[model samples]
Target: MSRMDHRNNRRKTWISRVSQYVDSSAGRISLTIALISIIGLYLYGREIRNKIAGVPTPSVVFRDKKRRRVLIIGGGYAGLLLAKALHHKLRDAPVHIEVLEARDKFYHNVASCRAVTEPGFGKQLWIPYDRFPVFVRRNCQVTDVHTNYVVTATNEEIPFDYLVLATGSINSIPSKFPITTASSQAVATLGRIQRSVAEAQHILIIGGGAAGCEIAGDIVDRYPSKRITIVEALATLLPGRAVTDEMRKVVTEKLARRAVEIVTGARVLLEDEEFELSGAGFPEPRRRVLFTDSGMALDSDLQIVCSGNLHYNGHCLQKLAHTHPTILDEHTHEVCVRKTLQLYDPMLPHIFAIGDVANCITSKTIVACEIQAKVAVQNLLVLLNAEFESGVGRDDLPARLKALVQVEPLQEFGVPGPLLFITLGRSDGAAQLPFLGVLGGWFMRRLKSQDGMTASWWRQLGYDNVLSNT
Candidate 1:
């Protein structure tokens, strides 16, 4: 036979054998399973690569020169939700949404406590901003905010037709990641903290608030034999929170069951230098002494302070304070906004603030931030649509002011009442709901403690591929 004819006959014989195998139900099922496994692996590998190298930002397309710009200053929970909501609401409209965040990745502060105790878990806590629906300009720290524009640390001026400040706040390490923290840096920081937690025989956690309680819970869950002490200035645990006495009791009992020590009505009296050095990390001898205002001295191998030393990220609005004196609260130092979430300035109605930076009478939790974001998005759309209907140019200040609609505030929007969820560890937690009152560990675990709600957050932010593994 000719070489070509011989090759063709060989191919036909192989095909006939494959057809014989495929004729069986088991062969078809096996082939389908193999195909599915191959596709699943490809998708998972793609997600891992994206997580490592980071996803590239989509190119901005300004189809119209008259397109309005909506600038959101923080990439926290509120800013990201607002950006996504605005993008979806204005998908067909002539508007552009942009988020300017100092950090390269969105740090999931809710999961920070767990990440500090559990190694390798930090990788899921810092998600890249590129996964969001809107454009995010990471590592852009705003220095000043004017009537029409904002100045970044690099002195680059970015003008927006409407501005939303959601810079959130800064907390101590492990509870909150620092500004400009990249994903790798955040993971490394968590790893270091985990090592410190694992090595320490006795851990001292100041402040018996939710953070301190959760930290102790996480540490105890990881190292059941380690000695953990929580010191609080308040008389009871979870002071200053909107939680009920029952909720506090539940949390306290859970921690007590874990053999965690609690000291209340006493404040740690450490100097700034000493407090910093203590919290920095494990030092030589790995032994430190802390004194409280009650003349009590406590010794521990490691210290973690959750004393609620939070500072709002509204310093960029300082320049505007000269003109709009009420732009920031005199005491809280947070941005002062009207019920409509707008900067309480008639001349600057186009500027709005939300999240922890806004002087809202709500808990500084992710739920409050998301609710405020929705309200801000609604009001912003009202103004945007009104301007479009009024046939006024974007630069026409007087006409734009006249075109503005009477926006509704958060109260008028039927905002959900205050809800508090405190997770002790992966399987234990407590929550104070609106009508449900206070709940125990089962509800808390199902609601938040199981996975820190990280999976839900990833899915909410448009990352289903990451959700599969999470």
Candidate 2:
């Protein structure tokens, strides 16, 4: 072989060996980095999830002999829907559900303004909770709640693995609870209100929110000749943070057509003190005097306060608020919750809060309550099932424990545009569904006002065969 050919061959051999060595080293380094990246990412993801989940609570451990208890306080719309959903989700699971409600029946308070105005509709408003699938403890007022138990007013200690708080807001007069849940007793209380309205020549409603607007509509519809006035402290009727001038004008015009008067930017005095009722712009011949903070005076035979939602900040709730300020609103005392509907405190994963009592959502209507109930129940079911599976010697802790689902936040309602259903009376009303814009005509009355949703609610509560008027 020639010297040139031999040299060329020798050079090609050196280049081939260099290329092979470099390729092998690069492959090993790339493989090592990929593995490290995957492991680090997994660990980081777990840390984030753990942080979101708060503290790992072993409070829900299940003993083979004992049935797990899921205690719910307050039998309002939120509580009822949660109980029903949980029951269905864990029908075969070994768990006991209990509802502690002060009243024996579920009073549809949304229709309350209409119920008190019309005596006949009172019966349809309150229905017994006896038929509920779970155990219903009547007259059971929860005075305190702790990590794993709740204390009743009678000093009864009810143990629970998981606790849900749905105690709704307490309203003022006219929107107040009935004296009793018994049909007869409720009828008597409602009768007195009806009789009072019948005797009164003039009525004044304080607070121009939904309650005030509804009550005004009901009274004016029943007694067209009676003088009715709405005294709102804010500048507009239906004074929500997001309420628009157009929405306010719509409600104001409807009520005005019914000859109901509205006084805005005036604060009504809640004291027993009386005024001359003939001062300033008010007319003379006062039957009864009413005074305001704005120096406005009016005459009315009956006055109903429909302002403010009083929180039942019991000693236990207050204690919780003090310890976990992040989970409780300082001003409202309503429990702060995550989008998952679980209590915002990372340490209290087993405890959940919903409905008007939970300040996470903007709207406090039944629509919002139902949405919260579903989200809370699904996540809770996953939690409880994880605990159950773990107790049964499941090795996959991560997989089982990650069952907690998330809930998307709801769009804000009752505001800048239209997202509320306000009935003027049996014949006239307005409604606004998401994406549907504003709705009117007889459809609104037929949906809610005509029967006050008595039938729809009864059926939803598992009374399929029950009569509508019952």
Candidate 3:
């Protein structure tokens, strides 16, 4: 072999070694960087998810705008829906809406009826308002009404441009036991109610509305040992509800089978520790001396007065009503102009009202409120188009679903609650429907029929976001 060939071979060997070293080194560096980037990305994503999911997004963002401001009072189904709608619609818009609620959490009154009657159901009713972004103010009951300003129980004044009065209606009886506070006392009281059913030998449920009837059914469902009686002043149970005849028969029979007694047209008057009833036989509202209309007045270990849902005055509602319901009255039965939801005065044009505080009415559902909030956010951006000739417009506006809402004389869901799921110790379930019509279910025997509440407001508060298992 020649010297030239040998030299070439030696050079080739050196180049091959260098290439192998470079390739391995590059592979290690690249793998290390990739692993680090993956770890960093995972951590960042986790933190973002936790914060974003802590509560529904605050308000909204607008386009072609500096910033939009909104204020909502109450975190009810209606109020929360409004906030969510605004965020979804105006994410790109310059909108910032704030919800002012009296409590730190949102308690759904709908589910309370069943929870109180049935065991292991109350905790599902409360969802803290802090889970969402609206600035939550707890223990601040609204007081004193005025134009553009809201005075709270604490005397601190909050100013707004547009006002909403989503405070809704105030009911008396159970309203006194609002689950919103989640006070230890309340939990204890609820426990006591359950215990009363377990220990008491006899129960007297006054009134025949959903509460009175359901309480009887639910008690029977829980403790069949208790003798339950329902005293209704009305001619029939669920006078104007939408229930079917078959359902009514089934309910009545079930209660009768359980030896449950019901007496219609019985007016109870309390004189001392005893209750007297006035019936039809005697001309002057004949009073029962010791026995009841059903001829069985035993000492009751528990007496539940589930008769009326009263309308106590609300300061925020009064002020909002004095200021803007008049404006909304003219725009009645339709969605309020988007910017009109701004916490500003409608007459002034820059101010708006949202949630229940505003007079924008259409069957006060959370979905409706959410839609109004979204529209308000989009419109705020449109109004904000001062620098440019063209204003911001809706790209993907949320479609408003027609909700079933009736407010003539302010009747709440006049339909009879589900009988199979009735809460009244069951001899007293009532159902009234439009066409299918006129029914009642007596679950006085089962007591544990339907544990699911129909209108749980906690869902609107986004409780399902975290408590999926519940």
Candidate 4:
């Protein structure tokens, strides 16, 4: 029991530490390889499927310099993916893709909840459209959409060979920035909101969905002293295909451990443009009270509405109302698409819709939007080929739309399986995969929330560095 014994123990501890490090490194390596393999197979299979479905490859360059104008309304995930795919897949092809977005930059809506709380991370979430190679007409709001043309707010008539409506959904202020907002302005808004939240002693978040839960987690983690509460309209938090019971339980426990209050089956009532909070015991000024339909009154110093976006069917539906009233879903208030992801009306084959605007029977998510963009792009390429082969112009192609002829219909967005992820904070989260029912905190954090994938998204959108652009 001397120096020799101590040296031996130290040597054994060092070996054990080395072994653990090696094991963790090996696991990470394996995960990386598996992910790469999955991505490779997905891209390869997609290319093969596109070829089988009569979509021209990148090598197929159209000789006719008479470029086809592809106009995309909305620069959300779906729209950006579609534009990027078109540019990459249809390289040197006779197609000119353009996006008309009201905003000057693409917003990272997924990370917005945390971004709002932590204003330092807000600017990282917005990417300027100019950073990408695709043509983006920022600050351009489409007043009306027609079969082959769109009228802008400025009374400009823009014609297109093909049209894509990826306008996405409209939500409240914090969830979605103002339509015509610039990146700097959006970041300033987040900063102001963050300051307000920091000053408030108690915070009430209405909605236990992803946004609400995320807001609670981020706020609680950053400001542990603040009292936080989340109220949801449904019986359980994040109901339906959003999250499983186990995931919900973990998140619920996480919030409970932080002493955050959660109220279910609560509906906020609006009176004179303000939440009806008078009947609550708490007096105004000192404490802000919120009245809910469930007879539950909550008091807080500050309130954040983490609710759904407003219906955005007004832009394109006005034109579709007369021609195809049945294209709109009664319950979802989303545009109904055929199996090909095209507008249900046979007359508008050149017109396509993706993302939240389309009723794909899946929870409105980025994963679904990406899949929809791929299908829509593939179909559009096929239609373009048909047009080129027939020597028909854009106007004539609609009448001979292949989907209408039943020769080759567009592929559906394909109902998305359960794929959900909810971050409790920066370091912890819960997720549900396709085959994997639910995943733990470490996995979810590493997969999504670590850097919020802002850099990854920048690379995906053809940018090398996000901070450089900022």
- Worst ten in a row by lDDT for model 2: 276-285
Worst 10 residues of 3 by lDDT: 399-408
The stretch of ten residues in a row with the least summed lDDT in candidate 4 is 276-285
lDDT of 4 by residue, 1-470 (tens): 99999999999999998668646967656664665465445434666665789964624333354778899998888899889988887777667889998887788878877775775778878887766778899989987877678999899999987888888876655677657667787787677777788788889888888888888988888888889988888887886665678878878888989999888887876453443322211112235676899677787788777776556544556765567786776554688788788888877777888998987777888887888888898788777766666554444555546533453655555676667778877887777765556766667667786766677888876688876667
TM-score of each: 0.81, 0.75, 0.56, 0.85
lDDT comparison, 1 vs 4, better candidate: 1
Order the numbered candidates by lDDT, best leading: 1, 4, 2, 3
Which of 2 and 4 is ahead in TM-score? 4
Off by over 4 Å in 2: 1-66, 178-186, 242-245, 273-287, 312-315, 321-325, 392-418, 464-470
- TM-score-based ranking: 4, 1, 2, 3
- Residue 277 lDDT (model 4): 27
RMSD value for candidate 2 = 19.3
How far out, in Å, is residue 91 in model 2? Answer: 1.6
lDDT of each: 0.78, 0.69, 0.48, 0.75
lDDT of 2: 0.69
Estimate the TM-score for candidate 2: 0.75
- Give the number of the best model, judged by TM-score: 4
How many angstroms is residue 96 displaced in model 4 relative to the true structure, after the best TM-score fit?
1.2
